[model samples]
Target: MERTRNSWKCPIFGDLNDLKDNVLPTYGDVMRFYEWTRHRLKYERERNKEPTYKEIEAIVVARLIEIWAKSSIPTVEPKRMKVMLQTYHLKCKNLLKSNPRIPKNTLEGFRLGSKALFDIAACKCQEFLKCACPKNKKIPARERGFITDQRTARQMVIGALDVVTTTKITKTLKRKSIRENSKSKRLKKPKHVRKS
Candidate 1:
């Protein structure tokens, strides 16, 4: 009798319910929700191309820079923020590779867009700082929270944008070169076939 109840409780009415009602709700749910949102945004970008992955990545980096720039020291600490942004950028590249509508050249365009956006932001910041540190001035507090100095925050935002843009351009160019090499090899193969 006890064994029957224990068996039923072991999974159906027992520990599983407690976990489902409690632990799972606290941890896995939130993490999965975030992942789902990320994937959703990725797919939306893939479909519309309005917000390219590079743009998204640059925006995030810009936010990071803005947060750090506001600090008295004006540096991105904790290091992990940089790592996560790079990881997300890589994921975007992989997603773009699988997307048929995202042209090879568009990848390059995104790279350029990121750099241009960063440059614009940085230039604006610098202009504001002609008296001193303008880079720290333009950071919108809504993006980076209320913790750091505005000028430092703005600089950090540009730095983060630069990092993502540079990494993406390098990766895309490497892929483009490989494709070109493959094309050249195919041309050479046709010549050899004619000789044979």
Candidate 2:
């Protein structure tokens, strides 16, 4: 009997090599190809009228499913997935516009393809138990203070030191004057006050 291609040398009985080699293309390769095609489409679209948003969305979702099927990454966040799919769809729409031979019927096909892909991505994401990220999450607000700059911080410290020194000198001077005034009052008092 003819020996089938030794799909693997490992003692394992499973046939994953065949699946990798024959059944589906690698995810990276497919995504790269898609990106190149998208670039071409973009260049073409710029010279022509752009596709509608709905049409663009459909194209992207469909392309995303194709990418997801082969990707090693099992789960994709819903928003990121949508963004990825949208980018591809817009690119495809641009490509289709440039091609003169593809019929109106093909546009309908693209729409259907997009919807099917969107549904598939949604189902897969749900199965994988991914999180729904908050829309409001953002970069933290900047701190408000005089300490933002090292130079400013140093200047502020110097200013504080000057205020402290001025306050101490004023207090010392005030105490000395009060003591001198009290001594003068005692010296001016009559000799009858000496008994006290």
Candidate 3:
């Protein structure tokens, strides 16, 4: 029998599906998802505290279920996942552009495939566990923070790929935005306390 090849080359969301189904998540799975948390939340890494093991484990079990659920798709090929992500990215970008008031900074991460994967991972983890997640019990402060961070990071990454430049982003429009922000900060001070 010809053994099937693995599609772990998808970078952010590997199609491992290696974890056992209907079983508790393992240490390795927790660690892997934690690393993905880092990948998706790169921008907020500075202020956000590192996630605890229980926090990751809480989400990892659903991830295992999500992965295993897809195991029957019969589609296991490298770069295939990447293409699917790109297609979805384009569709989302168009919808987001309906309003011009939104800032472009959030779009930066969307250009990277990692952002989509990060987003999908977050969604899949929660989606697969809708039935299992407690309906009445209130979530702890820490896990709530984790959920918020995931959404914030995904929003930051949802942007147009066309805007992506070949060079590293050194804040072209960001400089103007910073200046505007600094000016606004000064406006908040009472006139009596304002420094000429």
- Per-candidate Cα lDDT values, in order, are 0.39, 0.40, 0.40
Backbone-clash count (model 3): 2
In candidate 3, where is summed lDDT lowest over 10 consecutive residues?
1-10
Off by over 4 Å in 2: 1-75, 117-196
Residue pairs in candidate 2 whose N, alpha carbon or C atoms collide under 3 angstroms: 60-85, 60-89
Candidates ranked by TM-score: 3, 1, 2
Per-residue lDDT of candidate 3, residues 1-196 (tens digit): 0113332322223443443433223332333444454334432455446555445444544554465233211122224334443455354446355535545554444334333223222222343335343433333332444344434452322122323441223465577789999999999977777678
The residue-by-residue lDDT of candidate 1 on 78-157, one tens digit each, is 24444655554464446455666757776565443332211212223333324243445444334333222222332322
Candidate 2 residue lDDT tens string, 1-196? 1113333221111221211221222222233334343334445567544445555444544555554344222334546756765565455647455656757676556544432222222222221224343322211122112122211222221121346755875899899999999999999988765564
Model with the higher lDDT, candidate 1 or 3: 3
Work out the TM-score per prediction.
0.21, 0.21, 0.22
Worst 10 residues of 1 by lDDT: 10-19
For candidate 3, give the lDDT of residue 157.
21
Q: Which residue pairs in candidate 3 have backbone atoms (N, alpha carbon, C) closer than 3 angstroms, thus clashing? A: 107-159, 110-157
Error of 2 at 96 (Å): 4.2
**Model 1 residue 69 CA deviation in Å:** 1.8
Candidate 1, superposed: residue stretches over 4 Å from native: 1-47, 76-83, 88-196
